[model samples]
Target: MKIVVKIGGKNIDFKNEDYFRVLAQLVKEGIRLALVHGGGPQITKFLEKEGRESQFVEGLRVTPPQDMEITEMVLSGLLNKMLVGIFHRQGIPACGISGRDGFLLEGEKYYPASGDRKVDLGRVGEVKKVNPRLVHVLWEGGFLPVISPIAADREGESLNVNADWAAARLAVALQADKLFLFSDVPGVLRDVEDRDSLIEVLSWAEIEILKEEGKIRGGMIPKIEMAEEALRGGVKEVFIGEGKEMENLPLFLAGGKMRGTKVVL
Candidate 1:
């Protein structure tokens, strides 16, 4: 079975050997996996170092041209290689790449809701299509495909994409068995601030109601939306939660009990 795991680099501590070892175990167990990663914290650090402030609309970054440049540098260049290095240390061969490589992610300009004025989000782009051939090739070659979220526009210009949405699109295109969005939180909580309020499972209708009631906001808004998109696109199952939930990957694929919030149709 194939799985797509999107991990927030901010939450992952590469210094911890145990963390990467868990992932290496996945490969040892014969799971074909693709890792899509986000570098929000690292991007913010780069922007700050350059004396530029970061801005976000809803959960999306407002990437000015300069910001996009920094984003690509941090994501595709820095963080991507870092993750690959971690996997390598764990005895796993990994190919680090960005969405722009091999037409992995094709994108177009994205305009967010901002009334009639149409605010320019710079190089921010949403996934228009995903080609999973490269990912499959790498997986079959005994390598993990570690991907960055920077994609190319129709004109071949680089565009910044939300890694969560990008991973969802990849899962859909690859017909992956499962998609996991790992972060710091345990899962979707009834209250964003209350860790104990984690919701174990949610149907599309319940997710919609929670969204309507303003219970799901900030980063989670995009996560839930992407989970819904993945489910609708025919991915067998979707999970969003802390990285620890990865331990249950085998159980999840085997249709056994697993941790974290499961999104259902």
Candidate 2:
């Protein structure tokens, strides 16, 4: 199976090797996997240490020109290599890469459309195209690709992209069978405070209604929005679930249910 998995920054706990172990097991079982990761928390920490306050516009970080350098270093340089090293320890031949590598992802500057107030998200980009050759070559050569979401603009400069959206575009380009965004939450919940209120499945219509009803807000808004784009872009399945639920991926693929929400068209 061809699958794209995304891991969020807040969920990057080295102590919890369960997610890594599960991914390794799947790869050993002959699954073609590509991992896209984000280091938002780490970026924030480093930015604050440099006296830059992290700001956001509609859940998307409002990066400044100065912050772009730091973002690229943390995402493409540090976190990307660290993840490749982890996969190496799992006995997997993994290659760390950025979207800028071979222009795998080329994008234009992004502008937020939701907010009533105008704000600038410097160095932020939305994907314009995806080149799948590098990823396919890595997979064919028995190497797992650990991707950092750093896009290149027309001027060949780096742009910080949301990892979830990167994974979505990559999934569409790869024509992946499944796409999973693993974050801290179990799934889309009716009540943010109640884990038991987790919604097992959501359709596009329902998601729109939920948005209007204000059930979904903050970071989750873009997560689901990207899932919708992937679904519309010809990906077979997409799931917004917790990383731990990935341990049950085999069963889920075998037609069993899991804890995370499955976003369907």
> Top model by lDDT, which number?
2
The superposed Cα distance between candidate 1 and the true structure at residue 9, in angstroms, equals 2.5
What tens digits encode model 1's per-residue C-alpha lDDT throughout 217-236? Answer: 87788899999999999998
Candidate 2 per-residue lDDT over residues 30-140, each given as its tens digit: 899999998889999999999999987667788899999999999998888888878888898889999999889999899886558645699999889999899999999
Which pairs of residues collide in model 2?
Answer: none
Name the top TM-score candidate: 2
TM-score of each: 0.95, 0.96
Candidate 1 segments exceeding 4 Å error: 254-256
Q: Lowest summed-lDDT stretch of 10 residues in model 1?
A: 244-253
Q: In candidate 2, what residue range of length 10 has the lowest lDDT sum?
A: 111-120
In angstroms, what RMSD does candidate 2 have relative to the true structure?
A: 1.4
